[model samples]
Target: MGDDLPPDLARLRVLETWAAHYLTRIRARIAAVERQQAQQQTPAPTAAPPSRPGTGPGRARTPDWGLAEAGIGVPTTEIHRGDCWARGKTLVPVSAERARAELADGTQPCAVCRPDRVLNRLGSS
Candidate 1:
């Protein structure tokens, strides 16, 4: 094939190959540029509120000390088994189910232990 072509024509074939390779490279570059532009135009996620300091993994929110609206204190002792509040008035070790129900009904936790603090805080208007 080389023998069939003049030196100038052989040089032109090499230039053509170079141009093809350059075009492919340019196409890939353009695709990458398009992807970057698309990403820049898209919106980012909104940041969440920062959490409070000094709270531990098992530690929950502070429960309200106020009496239940029913005028009867939910047996807090059932929740915190060993812990009692203010001269046996409150109890710890609430059952998960009861807690959930109370929470669903907008009940709060014992102010002393605060096991139901999360529900109370959420339920409060």
Candidate 2:
């Protein structure tokens, strides 16, 4: 009589509200900790290498060679340095030698990253 909705349904709704509030609090706490971590960390004094674009806080150390794909049912379009700012539809890891060979075989080089520079720096080493 007092409540318009059924008792069980009302309880479920109450629990759902509580769960959402709890999740919000948990996410806030996690974000606070992440902010603290970012504040505490400092850049290195030595000359360090560049980081990948989306790896987090400019501290990534994962760079190699990769082939950028156009899309499904399409061929790879360009070669990219792992840390290239310009991203393709997809990337497939490959060896430096393979990248060099692919570049030699008419695969387009990424204009932004210029991966070919790394491959041909030594001039046949």
Candidate 3:
């Protein structure tokens, strides 16, 4: 009885050695796969300049002439009369008094807002 270690213990030792070897191989395989994946998936950085100050993600990349026109406070009729003004042809917002004055001066109400000329005045067709 003193010399008898169970057959299961002998088998357990063999399994432990095999499991250790298997785990080592698996770890090596995982490391190799990770390295290969990293090499394959890595993206090269671009050479474009960084965004300017005050700019944010999702900001329009193209020029926005509407904001530019609004910045100068140009009259809508002068900017958009012939479609020559492009995107900035929409009218800048005005106060109620200014709108009344414009209406009194024979300026036609915008088609979109026949009754409420003040709202959505800047949106172009």
Candidate 4:
């Protein structure tokens, strides 16, 4: 075949072969990079065991009256600093004095923290 072909045609054939080989390698590298990027974007699976009560990661701290709120001002239930076991409730931090006043105005204390007793002690002096 090389004997039948002109030199320029032979040279062109060789260049085309080289170009095809180079393009194939480039495409493979692009695919590898895309795969890497996809792996990076995927979220890792969380295989951590469920947290144990008062002993594992993210255990609930003891509830305190350091901060108080009335469940976003609806007065349904008051909240203190720690977890209240109430769902879908928002807390608005207030001063201890304001918390006492809210308690006086019939806002129920948080069942978890018992802010009523805490405020009573605060009011005592």
What local lDDT score does residue 109 receive in model 4, on the 0 to 100 scale? 75
- Top candidate, metric lDDT: 2
Q: Rank by TM-score, descending?
A: 2, 4, 3, 1
Model 2 residue pairs with clashes: none
Compose the digit string of candidate 4's lDDT tens values, residues 9-121: 78866766676556546656776787798788965677986444345556453433434443332335554644433312345656678778777787767655577776788
Overlapping backbone residue pairs in candidate 3 total 0
Off by over 4 Å in 2: 1-61, 72-76
Q: Residues 4-50, candidate 1: write the lDDT tens digits.
A: 55579688767666765565466567767877997889656659654
Off by over 4 Å in 4: 1-75, 82-89
Clashing pairs in 4: none
**Index of the highest-TM-score prediction:** 2
On residues 1-125, what C-alpha lDDT tens digit does candidate 3 reach at each position? Answer: 63554367787677666765565466567767877997898666869775653256874333221121322222334212211122232445455445455556655453322423332354321
Flag the better candidate by lDDT, 2 or 3. Answer: 2
Task: Evaluate all candidate structures by whole-model CA lDDT and list the values in order.
Answer: 0.48, 0.71, 0.43, 0.58
Instruction: Please tell me which model should have the higher TM-score, number 1 or number 2.
Output: 2
Residue 75 accuracy (lDDT) in model 4: 35
lDDT agreement of model 3 with the native: 0.43
Q: What is the TM-score of each candidate against the true structure?
A: 0.29, 0.47, 0.30, 0.36
Q: Model 2 — TM-score against the truth?
A: 0.47
